[model samples]
Target: MRFDELDSKMRIYETAADYCVLPGMYMVARLDGRSFTRLTKDVCQFEAPFDTGFRDLMAETAENLMTCGFRVWYAYSESDEISLLFDRDEQLFGRKLRKYNSTLAAEASAKFSLLLGHVATFDCRISQLPSENLVVDYFRWRNEDAARNALNAYCYWTLRKTGLDEQQATSRTCGLSVSQKNQLLYEHGLNFNDVPAWQKRGIGLYWEEIEKNAQNPLTGESVMARRRRIKRNFDLPMKDQYDGFIQSFFTRSPSRGIS
Candidate 1:
């Protein structure tokens, strides 16, 4: 067989099962840490329930993903998960699902592992939302999840500190309602409402315009110029307010697709 004919015959096997995101649909890539519970608790030994160092690592990894060659409009991170919202018009790799899944997972895993000095891994998947409202709901879902996880974690760790083993703590919190969990924390003198907003609501990353001082080469004069930067929001709104916040991004002018 000719070289071109042989190459074409083999390539079909690789591309036969490939799927792509359709045009006009919103794409959101969610990357989750693999085996992170053991990685953080047993190997890294990070502070239980929540730790600032681990939080920072997650935030940094999310930010890195935003600038790593994709038109990511927003990023949200909580616990060991990161969610990236891409611009609606994004057509990279002709919207290939496997390309996105593999690249993002590799990028996140590589960035996080380098930062932590350990071999951490992330698995990625893309959610194709058909409407803007669905996109808003998607983020709202994750936002509320953060709150639930935070409350449960605080309650679980508190019980653990009070001599409850893992099984005992999980058993105690299994059937507790939201109010009941809050009461549990109150009984331990830790107010769930007083926890850091970032822990409960997750962190958001988006681009913002800021002015910077620059020097004019011709006249040696200083001038203010505007530039876009990734702004980190540790304090995010909740419920209806959060829905409005995500909706607002859709109405903005098309992004320049910068890193």
Candidate 2:
């Protein structure tokens, strides 16, 4: 057949069949010490989320998940939880949902249970977003909500710890908006300069470096595509996609400061 005829036939075949690809909404929940409020204040010297050290810890955790087999996009709720966007079609990932959820939950429980010296557990769920715009807005909403809630909780908790009555503490916390909480972080010698770059880019700010050096742990092949990196992890049990898995920590690049 002529080249043009062959191309025309191929297009018709492509249109008649369904294909699977990555890039969809995923939620990554991390179960760490439930008392992160006190633990964070003790370890980092300030409230959670606003505390740079705590944020760094969360970043490392996200990196860990990315390296394992997930496309982790953003960390949310100021606790140990995160929200991720996967790189596989909904149907493909759905096939392994049970194993994915259980393994992640177990990994989190083991890691944080030891890290925090307390019992911790994680649970995850996946959702497919029909469009890219919704994906971006979803993350923005989750992160902002996490920030606001964490700040308010800390404000009330801090006041109560200082012996303020319940009503007084609640009333006092009402005035501490997210901006004011950020200011307090600054006053306490903490930096709020960067709002997680992972949240913005769906990967860490150092993604370029990661792309440069990351190799598939299972196949020893270089996998440079972000979407493929996410798929490698998702298809891990299948063993066929191992060549595309990429490590999360290639190099640490400074983030571009808040959005």
Clashes of 2: 3
Which runs in model 1 stand beyond 4 Å of their true positions? 217-220, 254-259
Model 2: which ten-residue window has the lowest total lDDT?
234-243
The deviation in Å at residue 26 for candidate 2 is 6.7
lDDT of 1 by residue, 86-177 (tens): 99889889999999999999999999999999999999999999998999999999999999999999999999999999999999999999
Estimate TM-scores for all models.
Answer: 0.96, 0.49
Candidate 2: residue pairs that collide: 22-87, 22-88, 23-87
Candidate 1, lDDT over the whole model: 0.93
TM-score of 1: 0.96
Q: Compared with the true structure, what per-residue lDDT tens digits does model 2 show for residues 66-124? A: 55665443333234565544442324344354556666666655665565555545666
